[model samples]
Target: MNKKQILTGFLAVTIFAACQQGTANQDKAKDGKSISAGAKVPAAPDAAILTFEKESYDFGKIKQGEKVHYDFKFRNTGKTPLIISNATATCGCTIPEIPKAPVKPGDEGIIKVVFNSTGKMGIQDKVITVTSNANPEINEVHLKGEVTEP
Candidate 1:
């Protein structure tokens, strides 16, 4: 094999060996309690989760320069309160408004997305991404429609 390929193979083997050694060390504890080899680590409690009622909205058709909005409803289905760090859109024409307060577990929240069709035409799709402390921390909502000439 070429020198570069040989080097790559050696690097891969070295990384694999290192990872195996790390896993083997996880079976032992300094306090004399031995963890079972097959034991799995438990996940953290009360991770936030977002359950959306609907992820997309279709406005059908609208004239150019018209503005429309939709509220994306969601619930905090996990054990903890949902805190949204930020919500942003794919473009300036689409603005997203997220909740300022934390959504408690089992409580609902809304993410409002307003889309402006100014200077836009044809089939348009706008996306708003929500970032929060929720598990799988990022979620997206979409607004799509046809913008007809005025």
Candidate 2:
């Protein structure tokens, strides 16, 4: 190839490599949290942890059309405050209530789950998914029971 052509290709390759290097450097800060373009990134957490007393509950046998409720207790076992962002249930028959306020470090909280057996029968298993600022980010609690015809 001609000298000009070779020199041009070399310059192009150099520019491309430099651009890639800059992009990779900006992808994350020194602490490893990703940095977004023109948007504020969330700060690294200080080890907010959530610990549950029990991950599952059994209501045993209940009559159809009856409702059952249980409280899933938890504690913030880390150095930072624990904030529950949301709580979701597997089905409409199960409803979960998560505290709106943050649970401070070493503090305790409760998540209440109510299962409606109005039209349900036989063995029923429901799940509640809790989202928080904890390390794992999500947690699951289960509710199981047998509903007999009234």
Candidate 3:
């Protein structure tokens, strides 16, 4: 083959291989085939899957200076244990608590959020971000309500 023809063929093969590289690290499909890159795949059997029963919470109308709290329930639906590494809030008025222990598969847990309406008034929306080893990595929950004077 001519050098020019061989170079073109090599370049084409290289491009094709490069395009196929990212999919190798992707998860498998239900049919036990590897899913293509950028395609959604089911959670790995050995990976943790976090499932939230409620992603948002509404505290209704709460009086200023009152402390409101809710338990955001979740379950580990994957085959592996779920570990919540961190839980944070958007502001100091809100606090979130996550368990230190790993949540085994099929086990349930709660993310406790305490909202302090001390200086807050009117319509308020606060967010709590939970980081875990579960599929998708991070999850968000909300606390919303109107704060009125007592």
Candidate 4:
């Protein structure tokens, strides 16, 4: 076949294959059952809810190199158990401890956070983010204070 004829044939085959592939995919999509990106799934009737009595604490002024701690009190107000999956602090100088076991419904819990002023100076604000099986899934607590020279 001449170069022009061969090129035309190749182009025709490529277009035909692409057209077939497109139709096949479209048909499969129409026949298959799948969840849409924005589809709303059935929510839990008895979900875990985390309610905090206090979300922020002020440790006030502390000497540099001193350590201060606070306990953030919370309760599980929902019907299901509250399981904390993770707790993280914005700075390494701050450490947060979560409940190792699940907090049952109507039961109270505490998240203890310790802030070390060793290397931190001046106005300090440490944030702790907690993730759990609670309805909201995520919660935050703050620790504020000032570190002065020792």
| Residue 134 local lDDT, model 2 | 86
lDDT of 4 by residue, 29-147 (tens): 23365544444444477999999998889899999999998899999999999999999999899999999999999999999998989988899989999998877778998999899
RMSD of 1: 6.6
> What does candidate 1's lDDT look like per residue over 23-98, in tens digits?
7765764556777676643434778899899888999999999999899999999998899999999899999989
lDDT of 3 by residue, 107-150 (tens): 99999989999988899999899998888788888889999998
Cα error, residue 69 of model 3, in Å, equals 1.0
Q: Among all windows of ten consecutive residues in candidate 4, which has the lowest summed lDDT? A: 26-35
User: Candidate 3, which segments miss by more than 4 Å at Cα?
Assistant: 1-45
**Model 2 per-residue lDDT tens digits across residues 33-78:** 7785565445457767889999989999999999999999999988
Q: Comparing 2 and 4 by lDDT, which wins?
A: 2
Task: Report lDDT (CA) for all predictions.
Answer: 0.89, 0.89, 0.90, 0.88
How displaced is residue 100 in candidate 1, in Å? 0.5
If the candidates were sorted by their lDDT against the true structure, best first, what order would they fall in?
A: 3, 2, 1, 4
Q: Model 2: how large is the Cα RMSD against the reference? A: 6.7
Minimal lDDT window, size 10, model 2 = 36-45
Q: Total backbone clashes of model 1?
A: 0
**Which residue pairs in model 2 clash with each other?**
none
Question: Relative to the unseen true structure, what is the C-alpha lDDT of residue 112 in candidate 4, on a scale of 0 to 100?
Answer: 91
Per-candidate Cα RMSD to the true structure, in Å, reads: 6.6, 6.7, 6.5, 6.6
Indicate the residue-level lDDT of 120 in model 1.
96
Superposed model 4: Cα runs more than 4 Å off:
1-43
Point out where model 2 deviates above 4 Å: 1-45
